[model samples]
Target: MLHAYVLYGVAGLMLVVRGIETEQRDSRGGASWNEVITDIGNERWTDYYIRCLHPDVIRPLIRGDLPKRLQDPEFRQRVSASLNLHATPGVYLCQFHQTGHLQPGDSQETADTLEQRRGAGLTLRQWLMVVDDCRLYSDVNNPASRNLAEQIDSAYRTTRATNYASNQRRWQSGTRQQNFAGLEEFLNMMDRRWLNWARAQLGTPNEWILDVPMVRAPAVVGQSKNVTERASHHLALSGSSYVHSLISCIVKFRFAYRFDRSVWQLARVERPDHMNLCEAIFSILASAYTWELGLNQTVSGASHQAGSHALTASALNQIYQQNRDENLRLGNVDKSLMLDEQLVQRIKEIKAFDKIKDQKFAELDEREKRVVEKGRKMDTAFEALMAREMSGLIRLQHRQALEASRAAPA
Candidate 1:
């Protein structure tokens, strides 16, 4: 006899975990072990890892650095489907639909049901899930919200539909206010005929409110010869449909510099690679990521082993201090490096991203390096200890990933 417990099912508006029920079975069988560890089980770092690793690991993986085995078409699809569920469970059911867990026409119904949940004041992300998972518009779902999600979705569709989507796409994330340009320059480049028409209707563009997002729908009192085109022109001029082009000034100019394996944490949003940006990420991993070990700080580098040497924080600190130099401090580094010189270069290059259109990524790939590597010389012993501990963490929990993956719902 085996048991099958329904955690959530399509019995009502929102599926709540149902009670367990047992049934007889000749052999015990269920989801694979990998599914359980990665999706179903409460394995260590399995939950928080995705959130923390988004900018660090997931970004790289998304940019085509996934493990070779996971690169297969079928495996990639599985990973993508798994990502859909894990990114926003219950709210996002793309994987369910793909796996025959959801009926063909259930997406709209789910959206309607989820729309009410959004009306009660869910987060922006939650509202976005409805937009992505359900066909319902935010305005249609709840007019009170000013249809922010719906409007954004519509803008995205328009942009993506236009040739501009590929033309104006950002190469990567973590680009925070590096450029310096005048708003007048942007206005000067606009189509003169269109701008003249817009000026006649809306008057002079207020420099201050130029970047402010227009919340309400565009108004066209009476039809003109080119009314539909004029409406688009008006919306583009006054609304936030293309605000990115207007906002060229720097918003935040915080410093972010990286070495061979260290990142100076100047801004919180600037996530650094855990392995390379050693200090910024190590503290979090050491404190939060190692909770499952039960050996918190006890055996940081296998000191508990019968014949191995014990590692100490003081020793690691000495190594870190030795490698880091005067440039480690913000006031001591170059202005260019501080501004993330590589990122600035990438943005400039990507602006003319069409220059090398024949090339894969259009020469944008070479410019994505945001960090300046000075190759700080940390003590070999310290490096060995860090590597050993991190490897141990992964190796120790490797089986859990397999188990959790298998345990995940089909």
Candidate 2:
């Protein structure tokens, strides 16, 4: 009776697992194994292999003897679901509300219940159970399982090759810097192409900027004349939206450069080096962007305040009189102090940054000089060693010749 009950229990478990897989197929539209793995991400996968996966499961999966119960299709589906849980554990619950995880007209009560369930991320044992199942279910014909196993090996190799400490040592000795030359060249080409595209759009006749001035100058602010035409033009131009799209393009290019496998593989070992020239350039660009943003905000606020009152002739006369009175009162004020404080502060910050950058450049130059001097000393020693060895060899040859001559019959 106990054996029969055990059989029934196993069958029930299989049924539950199979049903879950069916639901996943319906929800995911039968996504391929590769797609699922990609959704997990190479970095996460690497982390799983290196730091998370159980050693017991690893050996069985490696040896092709993983338990069958662990290999059920439900475990595979859960792998991707686990990633969703890892990233957004439905902590807010409202996050899952729009995700259709809750049915139509479902109250916050229902969402809270769902969040409770979703918040429970995959634990280590559960992940190991999946691995064990895959190992047992995996065969030479099980391409999905086999592919995952292969990825584990690939991740291991990548992680080992890109070890931070080893890469740093190599970099300090100036070993792996040449590896990035090709990648740098490719990025430079990409930059030039993007620059040309941006120049075409923003320069010579100035497309978007011109559109703004052209429409706004002709239209009277208070009147509804050409209202429809002006509105349409404004909508079409998107009001400087195109001007900011360069930011997105720049961001996309940066991510593309970061994740390109070929380029990443080359420098994978060398963690992020703040002393890199590229780092300096990026910092400068970011500072400039921040300054522009502050300037724009200040101008925008001032313009809004100035434009708040209607500019009737009497209002303008009043404004002029007020400005004259203010100017007379502040006539002896230092021009520098009278300037926008934020602008002055930014200038001071920039000068400080320039000084720091110069210091760093000088330090780098001195370090290079020391490295060069060290190399020269090593070269001189090497030359002296070679000369001594050659002289000793010649002396031995001469002594052998004299001894042979003396031994010759006369």
Candidate 3:
């Protein structure tokens, strides 16, 4: 009975592992070894071999020169999903001869095969070596292989830089910045757009930000009186909602400046031509900051006058010290501010602000705690909003693509 039970348990484990493997293969659009080879054919032996050797070895190739058959709308989508699954390390490798990163082995068969195929023979090991080569020597020699290779490299570098800068800017902007979530979403969208724009711009008419206005001016803003129509036109041209949002923000700020003197002055919206999108965004932020301060001051003032409650000097000091400590921990030394000194200075400012505000709430009250809690809630909401906005923007771009197809010349 004991032996039977052990055997059954081992069988069950095998079944489970087999099931998981099957599921993964299905999800990745993977075919049986025999099926993959047959599908590729002997004439395309190099393609089959590279893919069989390691899944990732085919990615750069596919992305660079997607097989004509695979370019079918449905097929391309499925292949893209499959390619994404090869993100794991050691799962794929490039041929040593292809990437020129690793020295070729002494096997005559491998070397001859590689030479015949023009450095296309790849094993699973070679796929990994290729990725390492791409990552390490990406900046090396500019080989004139194909236009696609250059475009992919250029786009990848631009995307990486844009992502880094956008993340850094978002961190600096903090939770207090007006429409922080919207702005973050916009930044992410802009990164994707800029990458696409860069790829399209390369050796083309649509080459830069300034080129967009010059080449596609009518499409940029649209001539429609209807708001939805105008927005749709802009969406089709820009290929992104962030661009639409930017344009909308600029137009709205300009209109607002026409009537509201106070808003105009605070925003510094002097001339229509001078009103850039970044400037408009900063104006909105300034307005939001003013509103927040006013609301906080009112609440603080009421609590002090009523003598209901107040934060203790110790708790206030603790909060200030914590902010300072956080700033220090971020270590902006190259930024010219010693962590400790910056923290101390910020703490001092907060302490001074608290002293002035504490007159109304000398006893430390629920009101002050509510204010702090509100700030935390705002920060959380901002993060969530940004995520939602990004998803929405991607969806909007897809929708625009569909619309443009429907309206295409028959």
Candidate 4:
């Protein structure tokens, strides 16, 4: 599982780097794209965003025996303290279609946006407490959660403010971010004698690996291998995979929010930011709950655009070229027909062949036209869908802001 996770991260990092390189080559100011491309290539900042957005590793952390273990008060307190200590400072809400603000420019929309922005951002500790402890989406009229929300909010504001200032000073003093080669670094550290001794003192992995089958594949005789091979081949398609990986990172992390770098820098604490590695992972994973809800349409639209631009979907251009080659091959076959016939019969046969070929060519042309038209219609529908989803997200944000206000202490 660790191996698969690292491989996926590496593959994603490669795509991100390649995509930036591609963008630079094609665009006018490609040369100007430097540090960000390099950082992403090296698995630095981009890894943080990618992990936060997808949280694929969260599956094991939540479902494993850990949650049951967390039910113990002492264990929960330790976990909570670790989370607060290492938690990345600041609230990272979805930007929602890169608008930063909603349409119609209404006063209500403005107020909702301001309300969300004005709060002292939640640290991971505060975020989890508010999200899990208060059960923000549920607990309608529940006084316990409401009171906890107020208490957590008060505590979080104070905690985040103090940390943010310290982080800002650290950033100003040119403190370098620790080179985190993701989870694999821990294994490397463990190999050293002193680190091995430290680990023996620290203890070993405790989380239970459940044997439950998440995806079941019933035994199939002959066809299974062939199908699996075909699927692997499709996954190997370079242009499509790179385009997909890049677009996913962009739409999920990049387009969802546009952070002011200066403001965001203040939120950075020295590494190791959170206490328990697994808990920190889970927190980042769970952080995407709201963003995923709102950005569904935007994701679809971006995927469609990648498919169209990269020729990743149907390879429509390749199909067109293939059709042209087929036409040429047919024409060549027709010329061979003339050699096999007598003079008078050959003339008649050539005319007959010409009519048949023209009919076949006409049919092929019609099919290509239909395919192109279908793609166009799909693109149009995708745009409309995105617009509707964005509007809905705006309303949802407004409603959430209102609900939060009502729940706040008077």
Best TM-score goes to which candidate?
Answer: 2
Off by over 4 Å in 4: 1-341
RMSD to native for every prediction?
Answer: 34.5, 34.0, 35.4, 34.4
- How do all models score by TM-score? 0.14, 0.24, 0.14, 0.17
Off by over 4 Å in 2: 1-339, 408-410
How do the residues 253-335 of candidate 4 rate in per-residue lDDT, one tens digit apiece?
Answer: 32233211111101222233222332333243223321321211112223312211111112322332443343354353242
lDDT of each: 0.26, 0.30, 0.31, 0.32
What TM-score does candidate 1 reach?
Answer: 0.14
Alpha-carbon runs more than 4 Å astray in model 1: 1-140, 158-332, 335-410
| Ten-residue stretch with the least lDDT total in model 4 | 214-223
The TM-score, computed over Cα atoms with residue i paired to residue i, of candidate 2 is: 0.24
Candidate 2 local lDDT, 146-234, one digit each (tens) = 45434432332322223233322112232333322322332233234222333464545433321210000000011111212211121
TM-score of 3: 0.14
lDDT of 1 by residue, 350-376 (tens): 344334444646445554432222222
Q: Where's the lowest-lDDT run of ten residues in candidate 3?
A: 213-222
For candidate 3, give the lDDT of residue 193.
30
Model 3 agreement with the true structure over 363-391: per-residue lDDT tens digits: 46767788889999999999999999999
